[model samples]
Target: MSVRTQESALRIALVFPGQGAQHPRMAAGLYGHEAVFTAAMDEALELLGADGERIRSAWLARTTTADFDDVTVSQPLLYAVDHALGRMVLDWGVEPVALMGHSVGELVAATLAGVVGFADGIRLMRARIRQFAQTPAGGMLAVAAGLGEVEDLLTGQVHLAAVNARRQLLLAGEREPLDRAAQALRERGIVCRDARARQAFHSPVVDEAVEASMPDWLATPLNRPRRTVYSAYTQGVLTDDTALDHRFWARQAAETVHFAPTLDRLLADHDCLLVEAGPGNSLSTVARRHPAVVRGGSEVAPLLPDGAQDDVRDRRSVAAAKERILPLQQPVRA
Candidate 1:
């Protein structure tokens, strides 16, 4: 693909979803048809060794949710699929001007943006997952309330995991407090659903895991991102001076994911075409609802279909890409 000047470059933004979006046999259709995607998946499986086989079997079996419920299994599998899908989009000549990720999905963005090598990213994810699995098991609740509303109901035990949107907040902690908080929210006629997370990610409950996994995470080499990377960790764009080291990642695991702020920054800075490069439209759905996205007339698309229709999925992706190109040629305004 030819490079465009700063003024004329297509400001495309690729967004990835984290956990809670995984399902069996996701992107099974694109695997065989797209050579670049196939190579990426095969390489990821090879790097994973036995765990690779386990993920592959789970993908093929398409059986139970338990197959992906394990953090160790889900993290690597999601990374592999998300990375491959991003590569497939690039092969289609739809290069991103920026990238952002939700929670664990940041690993994929980091790799694509040249912050870390592909293999090292996978190793870091595996180590992170294993350490998380060793921690005390907890739960997360998706509360339909703003941060202020949820904080009003919080005890000393629970922590805010993610600020997804104005009304979408994820609360994480021990089962007892989580349940209590959910009950309290429900009593007020607020919607609260179980996130079904195996561990209390992005909360103080995983401090032990963060400490255990620090050495491996720090050992992984990192550089300045080749493209702009919006950080859920800092709730802004990652700059040259921003540290992309072990401490940063550890803090990320133990801090609230400021996804809404990151989205706001993306919309304010660029005329971005937001593409969800994961199993489902989870992130895309959220992007569409953002006031900035709606007012800016930003286009959002998903790379894979929710169902088993492989042919239809391919057609939709192609059509969406074609549609994205036209609007991207227009001048961007804040």
Candidate 2:
């Protein structure tokens, strides 16, 4: 019996962030360099029956605030940025062996996997964002420097959102519950930091959103992915025949993400290069700091908000990141 060997290939994992990562300037730089990226942005505007330029400008406003806080804006913006960056990577001849998205980012990953089309994805995202945005007055916060200290402090009122590492944890719920949890953590000498989003994602508060958004979710066609896509909900990779159904993804907005465990399996399977394909270095920051990860992607620019400077895109950062990935891109040990 000849057993197949899954060689440690130079595998790429194109990752995107959840709604919390949305920014006003998302996907600004890829306008010219990546065609699909630009097309996705245009499609988003057109699908919503809005003027493309005006919509883009309103999102790119001078205020240092995010337009994505508006579900109408965030749903499309995140999809556009992630798809655009993935398109650019494809153009560069780099195909990811796997894909993953954090919370809402999973929708983008679904699109990349061909689990959904760009237009249908935009429509569904719009509905989903609206539901989540309307999730009553509640939100999420991050507690830094140890889950053990914070876990004991969390009462049943609030739920743990994500455990990024041993020391980093995210808690989400109504503001009051989060406040209580944060206060308790502080008493235990834990440093708590909050993410800059207006709503609590991946927690039970958005159950209403999930229920109401189901119609639109099912209306969208599910397609087969071009590759394997890992689920934040299931804490593992989704195979060709199965993935989180529409309802599962919708419910995800109201559940906690099992990020650390999902990542543990991803890194164990391949020679991973985790690229922050969308806005901000939030996910990249976690990956580099996580004990499970070692070498990762070189670029660290948010995919949107045109013209945000990237240290990685600079001549020097490119060289440094490339140096780390060079061996994997080639076959021989140099």
Candidate 3:
């Protein structure tokens, strides 16, 4: 469809979850049951090559991984699952007003937006996982406080990784420093949760590590997105410069995600349904806190149940999510 026609379509915004949102058996139920989802997931994993095989085996076997958060496992898996879920939504005949994602989730959205091809994204992520794997052991923690409340707690190693919501923040750093910071928060009566991650993503410690990506980025094909995209990295609508900027993708792992502001920009433009197409309700939870949603001017739909829920069937959740978005599209378009 033409850009003008696409712009005139219904306003449905998809928000993708980043790292730490993963868990065992996420979307496993859809592997054989749902055609679109199954095909998309299979295609992505196949493109992932060897690592894809490993992930697929473990997922189907339902093996409990000791370090499920490690980038090698988490990144590729999330990319595949998120991408598949996004494709499933599109299959429902919904056209999003824009696409937005948090952290690595941005890459998933970019892939769907045609900013990067599926095979190329697989290449970039595989290369990224290898590079990130070499970094020193580190961790990420979600703290329930604004930067003002936690700025003094940050060290050279432990820095702000993400601003997820008004008071929801994430910190990343080498193991000890991040743990120490988390301890401090706990002592101060602030709640903090560990991310299922081993690499201190978005930390400067990885800045040099990402430098090696210059060649990879240059070698990879880059293109402007055919669809409107919002970037948490840029805290605004994605521009051609940002989309095609090799440096941005290269440095993404070490840069803080400004998800709150990015979502604000999207909602400011259109009162759309927010569908989180990922493993968990992390993005959905954050979206609920927005005033537009709370006042019923906007809505939030989750494509999957929380990773914490062992009984929630992913396929059923997809059906439920479909019902939520499809019914609302006509009203929003009106």
Clashes of each: 0, 14, 0
- Backbone clash pairs for candidate 3 read none
- RMSD values, in order shown: 3.7, 5.2, 4.1
Find the candidate with the highest TM-score and give its number: 3
Error of 2 at 225 (Å): 2.5
Residue-by-residue lDDT tens digits, candidate 2, 1-334: 2322335345667888876676655555445544766676666777755434555775666444444465556656677667766766665566676788887788788887888887887777666555666776667787786666666555666777877666677888788878787787778777776675567666777677878888887787776777788877788888655553676756776777877778777877655678777776677877776554543422232333323444324333333444544444544231
lDDT of 3 by residue, 31-70 (tens): 7777888999888788888888887765565655765778
Candidate no. 1 TM-score: 0.90
Q: Please tell me which model should have the higher lDDT, number 1 or number 3.
A: 3
Candidate number with the higher TM-score (2 or 3): 3
lDDT scores in order: 0.79, 0.66, 0.84
As for lDDT, the candidate ahead, 1 or 2, is 1
What does the lDDT read for residue 24 in candidate 1? Answer: 77
Which ten contiguous residues of candidate 1 have the minimum total lDDT? Answer: 325-334
